[model samples]
Target: MALTGPNGPVMTREEVDRTLTRLGAERDAVEASLLALQDHPGRRLLEGAELSGRTRERWSEAEPGLGLLWSMFDTYSEALAAARAVRSRRARPGQSELYEMTELLRGRGVTVSAGQLPQGGLHITGSTRMSEQVSLTELVERMNTWYGRIIEVASAADAVWTALPARIDLLSAELGRVRALARSVGVHPGEHPAGDALEEMAKELAALRGEVVADPLAFWVPRPGAGTGAPGGSGSAPGTVDTGRYDRAARTVDGLRVQLEDLLRLRDDADERLEGIGETLARADATLAEARRARGEVLAKIASTEVPAVPGPASAMRERLAQADQLRRHGQWHRLGPLLDTLEGAAQRELQRARESLTSVTAPLAIRAELRGRLDAYKAMAARLGVSEDPELIERYDQARRMLWSAPCDLRAAEYAVMRYQQTLRPTAGPGRNSV
Candidate 1:
């Protein structure tokens, strides 16, 4: 009946079933009593106090009223046979395997019920019924649903993959036009020529592709709307003309388009030139997909191997901290950015794994502000720590950033450094002011 996760053992089959059954009955009673409670006189006025006891418990705890009711339904649907058997009092002997099977689900923050012999259904937690008391497993599941989550990231990647050629074509044409204008005035364009611009575009396109290929399921936000610009507006973002080189490819293709239009005006050689750009785009798409797969493999390394090997987020920090020192000694600040981003994501995720796997109805709280506060605190702490042992201090910073995985991150060193920063505060700021 016990479900094992990184945090510990979570809800037993027995516990989930009982909780669901109790919640369902309680909800029904509360709904029926609401009308009577609203119309009754005094103690007759209190004859059916609908919002008391468990109902009030759900409300005060900020649990969703409707979602809890539906949770019962999902539980019953996903584990119908087990639910029916539990309700029917037909217990199945040697049912330990049932608990084992649900281990994957419960570890993932899913609340499952049944398996008292052949009964099975999983009750996935909906957002509303979930509160802070909810397990971290559920939070991870919610992460799965989040806008910046892996699947959404993949959708964005596909979009960029699809849109890149158009962007590149436009930029390529602009480059061509600029070069022609430069030459017409007896001036040469930049030594690299319009062709070099295409190469730059290709490089950026390749990098974006590599990141996507490495992990289609992590996080990726498209360029405002992919290649910048509003939904229907012309591309206008600065450096977007470069689209980080995306524009180069776009304009080169645009160059061909302009050529085609002018040639049609004069019956010149347009068809062959336009077909060349089409070929480049077709090849780019195929190459992009290959790169995207490579990215997936990298993410899998973090998710399956690196993350699981660390025991938990806390331990993972220890491992990352150890590596960060070596990396910093080599002056590898560039590596640190991705490492921090990845560690932040993976550790926070693993933390949820621990929380969900340990306790049901005990989810961690939101920490958006905590994370920002930690970043600020760490900045000041790093400043203080950086004063003497700059190198050692940086090691500590890398370690601290890796170590503190809370949403609203925690800053142990910053708290320790409070006395150091005490005298550095602006004269006009105060305890009651926003200057802190």
Candidate 2:
């Protein structure tokens, strides 16, 4: 018999030496990898940390694979050692020794007890066996499989731990500072929207940190070709941590911080704003007073003309301005901000309304003054035309003058009389006169 097995044919002396060299190197490399996995920071953290969710479930299954790796490494070492011993028996082995070496290296000559096989490790699934015989090549493949599985879980957990927890801690500190600033400004929860949001964000960050610590794998996002990309093995690629929730919370906090800064600016400028409002109210009151006086004059001088009523000062706006000042004094900047905006708008409207009233109340007096000026100008033109002594011209001019000069002047009657006087100043058409 040639003593052929799974890998086929007994090896020559040179072939056995070459095989021993390759297997020896492979054994050393696998041992180094196994020790590295044992001491990996991620694995150590996972072992001690209180885990939950996907990380918990995965660790529960993958943890046993650690023991299975060591057991399988021992089996591999023993097989390699047996092959070396067979070759060492002679400077060059004969057929019997060569056949034995081939069986140890390539045949199904390694025995693994059922107890050494963790359920999640080798995944052997035939009828129960007290021990199972597998080739040294198959045993190496099994160790590589379990090694890849355990590393994916450990590395992912470690990546999340490295990325999120410290950042969340820094955000929490910033939140604390903002809360203190809000209290100083009287911006408490239920009193201001920004304050309420800050409170909510504090809770959100705390919960986010808790979840990250307990189940970091939940926040990991594997790259598209993760499993096939890991070096020296088939496992996950080093994917990024999911920072979506943390980023949103950070933005919200930044917004609230801006709002508080605005309130601080408002506090510093409250005096200037209040003073400007007072000046505007003063102008509106002065205009209204002038309108009232004009109304009186129009009633006394103009006849049968309706005058517009002038309203009083902007007392409501002034009162609100006072209230706004009070709020500023008490550091209630949120309330003061809106009140100042309303008062500014109202003050402008009040000033405009007052000016309009003055214009309306004095309109009739202005008309009477215009008519008087027109009547006098026509009388002067008649004198220049040498018609000042004409009986009809004199009568019309005096009548229009009386109506215009008198108190409570009838503006309509004065206008008619002025027109009649102007007609009298024109020459009658006659021979050799040419309508002079």
Candidate 3:
């Protein structure tokens, strides 16, 4: 495949075969390059080593592989082209040329697709001042054009490929270390793939690795795991440990791997469904960010909100209940009735406020707004319907009821006032003189 000028004599089949044999040798050389790359251990490069000491040398060696592959590819392609040209020329030379190229490629386990080559651009650019004949000159031009991209891709791939074997060994060693530590700690050391298994694991580990690789900040989030401070201040309930849950979680990780493979195959194209490897990672990052922000906001709100809890002296409610029981046993109907009235009022208002809070937290902007509006309307109705002091009186009534029902009892006057006030308002006042 290495282009040299036709020097000594005209081309013959024997000479061409010799040249092709050399091409086959180069193919072999390139194929052998894989093991070399593996031997070099490019872990540092993968770890972000760009052109460091050993990398540059490995990179330089890796660079030559590109040209080698390119040459093999070109030669195979040319053999194909020659066949095509001979075929076009009444199946004379082209057919025979095609036969020769096909034999060589097939022998080397290579499948050359000259017909697959793009049209128009073809030529050899490598300076071999040793040639004057243009036997494959036009074909080389096309080869060079195609070779550019091939070389570039191979160069990059080789850099990683070259170091892969060593990296795998490195990972294997590390995993062994980890296993030893786990054994020392009396924990199970799980099996993991060799580092070189990335390509094999690529499909299966796509989603998981994508998250770890692309967005470390997001994936390593502090999850609300055992002992982790989470919402509702929920932490791990301290107790003697059960390993069952840990085992289940480990199994879940396996499920995650399955999910990753499914994603790689089924969602390779989609971005929105978050089915692809890259998108899954991006979505996780975004989801974690939002979740964290929400948690903080809720904590802040609870810390600062002015919502009151129940009504009065918390112990007072117990005392009042006891007093009511005594009054009832002694046939003190008057006191019992008044106490009951106070408890009802305080309980009603407290219930209403609590309900409001629940609604506001859940349906903040709308449900709470509607409830407030209803209360406002009721107040307006109270005043507009000739009960000028009814709104304030109703508020006091509610507070009294709340105090009596909660662990408190201090609204004696408010309860008595409600009773008297209740008698004054007719049933018709509410839609038709309804009682207060």
- TM-scores, one per candidate: 0.21, 0.80, 0.18
Residue 321 Cα positional deviation in candidate 2, in Å, after optimal superposition: 2.2
Ranking by lDDT: 2, 3, 1
As for model 1, its CA RMSD to the true structure in angstroms is: 42.2
Candidate 1 residue-wise lDDT, 37-98, digit = tens: 22323212122334333223322322222233234334433443443354444353224434
Clashes of each: 53, 0, 33
Q: Per-residue alpha-carbon lDDT of model 2 for 1-436, expressed as tens digits?
A: 5666556888888989998999998999888878878887789999999999998988876777788789889989988998898888999688889888888888888998665454444343422768878888878777776787688888888888988999999999999999988887789999888888988999999999999999998998888765522214433336799999999999998888888988888888888988998898899999999999999988998889888888888777877888998898888999998898889888889889998999899888888888888888877766666667888888888899999899888888888988887776665222454242
Candidate 3 structure quality by residue, lDDT tens digits, 306-343: 33222222345445555655654554333344465565
Give candidate 2 misplaced runs (Cα > 4 Å). 1-6, 12-18, 88-93, 115-128, 223-225, 228-238, 365-436
**Prediction RMSDs, each to the true structure:** 42.2, 5.0, 27.2
Candidate 2: lDDT over CA atoms? 0.83
- Candidate 1: lDDT over CA atoms? 0.38
- Number of the top candidate by lDDT? 2
